[model samples]
Target: MKATHQPPTTGDTTPADLLRGAALYIERHGWNQGAFFQLPTRHRLAPACAMGALRIAATGTTDSIILDDVFTQVLAAQAILANHLEPDYDHTTDLEADLNFEVISDWNDDGDRTAAEVVTALRDAADTWDRLHPTGGENA
Candidate 1:
């Protein structure tokens, strides 16, 4: 299922926009496997995998991905990503739940998983975020 929403281009791109962009990026290029990430410079516009695209969207850089980093933006992005992966996941309520990278990797690396599924997941997650936030994920 292809997402009809286009990536936000305005200066105020929100978290949901980032997710959408990730989906569009994967759609335009292709899914990457067997690596954590590759810069858009390398793979046209696509990151190596779902999580890599999210990280790039969050950090706007190819720096090392430390999933536990306390940085504000990454943490916020991770929360949104985590919530999408598992609806019941709440850091305060369920510490044992798999957070960002693990869950995304498991799904992305599944042998039968196709790029379309990954793109759909990202787009669906973004739609979920929009519905929950209602403010377009800027204040989320």
Candidate 2:
């Protein structure tokens, strides 16, 4: 005799289960394709928004004006993930190292600071954000 499989009810689903499902979906469909998937109505919007923010950050395009708040959230997500991987990981120092490798030959000098300096500033902002929102499993 054949047996039927039953999907877990919504009440039985945990956040980790949802995240694992999402990660699997992304792995199968690729990040861009995964981002286009319609988010479930009952789910919190933060994950969807963070996915969008990650897309923007990955593009590295300066054409669109991303708001500071959105960027901060993205950085916060990055810091949180990094912290999870390595407790001693310093996101700010990493950002500075990444910026140091950037090619800014075409970039116009605004008489303010170099690209690496900008990264340092962003790191500072991210530090402030991390302090405000410490990493916790309860969020998951």
Candidate 3:
């Protein structure tokens, strides 16, 4: 089933908000097998965007200079996944051509870092975000 992409909007700019948005996007899009075909444009874009926001918060980095790098890493990861899934398919088209993937410019700048390192940092940031913004009334 095809659907129009709608970027999420909210007043909250916290890392938790970003993570939640990412998770929601993934949940709505489905991460299991055969789900890829059903993903909306924004859903395909969420992992990297969410990871970028989490990395920025975790490293306390400024968003200006590092976001490009973050996006690069995200695209790289997507490429890797795409290649893994289908070597003949051009996965970059979805990420590069999608108009809904907005480049965020308002965040602070953190130092340069690798996507591998960012993955670790994103994990910590996600944990912290979850702790700080627990759902179901659970203590953070």
Q: Which has the higher TM-score value, candidate number 1 or candidate number 3? A: 1
Off by over 4 Å in 2: 1-28, 31-53, 56-65, 92-140
> Model 2, residue 105: displacement in angstroms?
22
lDDT of 2 by residue, 16-113 (tens): 33223333333323232223223433432222222332323332221245455434433334444334333454543436334322212112123543
User: What TM-score would each prediction reach against the true structure?
Assistant: 0.67, 0.29, 0.27
Top candidate by TM-score: 1
Q: List the candidate numbers ranked by lDDT, top first.
A: 1, 3, 2
| CA lDDT, candidate 1, residue 2 | 22
Error of 1 at 101 (Å): 1.5
- lDDT accuracy of residue 119 in candidate 3: 40
lDDT of each: 0.61, 0.33, 0.34
- Model 3 over residues 1-140: C-alpha lDDT tens digits? 11232222222334343333334443333322211122236435322333333333322332334445444433433333323233465544544423212221111112343334334333444455456456522111
lDDT digits (tens) for residues 6-115 of candidate 1: 32334455657667766766776567766756445642554557766665555554467434432344445545666677777663123433456566778788899888
Residue 46 CA displacement from its true place in model 2, Å: 20
RMSD of each: 5.9, 15.0, 15.5
> Over the full model, what C-alpha lDDT does candidate 3 score relative to the true structure?
0.34
Once fitted onto the true fold, the runs of candidate 3 whose alpha carbons sit more than 4 angstroms away are: 1-5, 11-14, 17-112, 136-140
